[model samples]
Target: MSSLTVLVIDDEPNLVRSIQFSLNDQNIGLHAAYSGNEGIKTFTTLAPDVVLLDLGLPDQSGLDVLAQLKALSPDTPVIMISAHGDTRTAVKAVKEGALDYITKPFDIDELELLIKRCGEQQRLSKELRFLRSKQIHTQRIIGNSHNIQQLREMIEQIGNSAAKTILISGQSGTGKALIARSLHDIRFNDAPFIEINCAALPEQLIEAELFGAERGAYTGSVQKRDGLISLADNGTLFLDEIGEMPLAIQAKLLTFLENRVYRSIGGGKERKANVVVIAATNKDLKEAVDAGAFRADLYYRLNVVPISAPALSDRTSDIALLVNFFSEQFAKQEGCKPPIWSDDVISQLKTYPWPGNIRELKNLVERITILYPGQTAMPKHLPNEYKQNPASSRTEDSNYSSVVENKERELILSALSQCGGRKGLAAEQLGISRHALKRRIQRLHIDL
Candidate 1:
């Protein structure tokens, strides 16, 4: 194991020197503090891997110190150092926050073992956080369209700013979550990225899951647990589908967003977490607020830096690029060579309005790669839904127009007729901006 940085808080110079001497062979960096205040100052600065806090301190009780340290960085492991007669207090320290305790007349070997255990556990957790980031790394936002370029610039600008709370608004499958991860990678790459879907968790349990709960706070509560906010200290906490969050929880969330302070369920000491909150939602928050389903105050608080994830139809030009990327990705994932995509298939894909966006596009590529590994993939091999949508057999009539132009006309008319000639609703179903739909209508010379 790598050397562990340990902060020892005790008044005994002789005992401190003894520990330093005994752990000399371990190559550890030891910081000594003879009093509680000194220990806190050093802890706030050092952020050592593990702490050996004395249960009895000269200036104040150690339990109070433990609570402060926990509020600052809950993930940091701490062990209690107590005298033989203070054994009961040591165990209570464990309940308070300490990972383990060693009564004085402590064996040096046992102390070394405890330190190593803490180091190993922390090493594992770091690895897990790295793996989570790695998974996001593989799913890069791939596109070169104007909207994508603007979105990229926005991420860089917002990431560089001091804004702590951001609201990501977009339709489902439009890569709102991807945009959130991109923002996280920009600023908090080294720190943990904790996320929770507010809509996925049960209404009864959402509060506890996000803010945590004290022991016996709920029916199944067995032990005190830290919330995602605490876990994401000095990092990013992604609240997905935030519009679906309950009204009561929205008020509590607003309090935390404003001050970076929160209280757990069953209410313990108010804890502070330095976390950048990135909230994503598919719902129209303004509409939801007006409808009395979402809190207005919370909505405004979270919208400090609003980000919109563009739908696929807004960047139809990038579909070919995305198709190539996904095909190569899924082919490698399936342990097979990527199938050759015909130009006809690419053209057909570009013509069809992708309502499900990139996610749907990715699924299509993955499915095709699995079924036809090395063969040439054509429009014929594609799903009938893809072929039947806009590119009907009538595109060949010379009196009509070019295949691409005819296809666009048909798609717009189909969407328009289905929505009873409502262009706004049709534009939504087509996954394009209202302006894009308007431009298409003018270009296609379609009658109302």
Candidate 2:
């Protein structure tokens, strides 16, 4: 592979020379520009993979230059350099689209790591853009509920740092992948998101899949291919269902996590992998560790920062929003009018134990939209399991009984009013016959 190029922008000639020399010693090509204007011109001409931008320039501010460069090439990653007291300025640069910011007189090692991360992020962003363009509909994390609000706050804090390892734990369908993707999009949208389901992979081939095989590492290895870890170098490798990773492989993973290095299967050379690993699992890894099924050391290595995806039950308030979101999404894909859901439908959705979480709810919405046309989703529109199980109707507040009764009464009134007070017509509109409507009305002792 060719050596990566880094462009350094600073008014101080001494700082520029030092950065250039240090980077060159590492065999990375370095270019320098003395002012923001020159830096933008050089950046445009050289198209360096990463830019170390000094926030203060003689002619123009670094933030202005960053804004211009971003406009020119949105995918390019910029790292702002600031003086000791200019931390606020550096932060403003980040908000203006810089990849990250570093303090003036930054450690050589830290600058190198930042440059490397920028390159990785750039590569990943290209891949994600491609994936997004191909996808039919992408689900976004949307909510102002306390749970969602807290998660967003944490994600913002995490994204501001260069932390590499993150563990996202939650029950199945609780949107672990969504959170992982959010993190990737926030910091490393410039890199390819390589996702692998550990639970789905065969244990025998898992190692080779992760670390790459050397054209004959084992049976069926016809070509030398880069492993996910290698492919995600400077990018994110999202390991879903990571708890299912075999114990033997966990040891190898730990080695890579510890040293940021790995040897390909059947290869003699040990290569450094600068990938950011984000592992997610539905199972309780602590319990697994206690049972001797999971390695505690590996768990700790991956859990540098732990994030929990809130379950559906934990954030029921978001269900109505989610349902509307998914309903419109499916409707657009299917080329139909977006379906609406009555409050009763939403109420039932909020009450059901979403064992499958957001994913399950999304699937249900899709199924309902596809199967029922020109109709709002109601209790009858739900699947048999949700409909038949009255136990699913329990809400946190038992006063929900009044809510259900109100819904029932509203439906009856709407049916009668829509049918112009004709019992037979109202019953038919309500999807029941006149006899059933009469019985329900009598049982509830409704005036109308």
**How does candidate 1 score on lDDT?**
0.81
lDDT of the structure predicted as candidate 2: 0.79
Q: List the residue pairs that clash in candidate 2.
A: 121-190, 123-191, 124-190, 124-191, 124-192, 125-189, 125-190, 125-191
Runs in model 1 deviating more than 4 A are: 1-139, 391-448
* lDDT for residue 31 in candidate 2, whole number 0-100: 91
Give lDDT tens digits, candidate 1, residues 1-448.
6888999999999999999999999978888999999999999999899899988888999998999999988768788988889887886676566767888898999899778766654554454344345535323777668998788889889987888999999888999888888888878659999999998988888898888899999899999988898899999999999998999899889999889999999976899999999999989999999999999999899988999999888898777667766776775564444565666787788877787888988878876775555455778887666785664532433432254467668878998999999998886566445676787789778989
* Separate clash counts for every candidate: 0, 8
lDDT (Cα, tens digit) per residue for candidate 2, span 1-448: 2467888889999998888877876767999999988888898899988888898899988888999999988868788899999997886676566767889778999888667755754554454444345422222675547998788778778866799899999999888888888888778647888999999989878898899989877988999978999888888899999999999999999999998899889999999988888999999999999999999999889888999999889999877667766765775565443444656777777767888889988977876665442254668867555664647543344453465567678888887888889998775555444665787688668996
TM-score, candidate number 1: 0.57
What TM-score, over all chains together, does every model reach? 0.57, 0.57
Give per-residue lDDT, candidate 2, residue 54.
90
Per-model CA lDDT versus the true structure: 0.81, 0.79
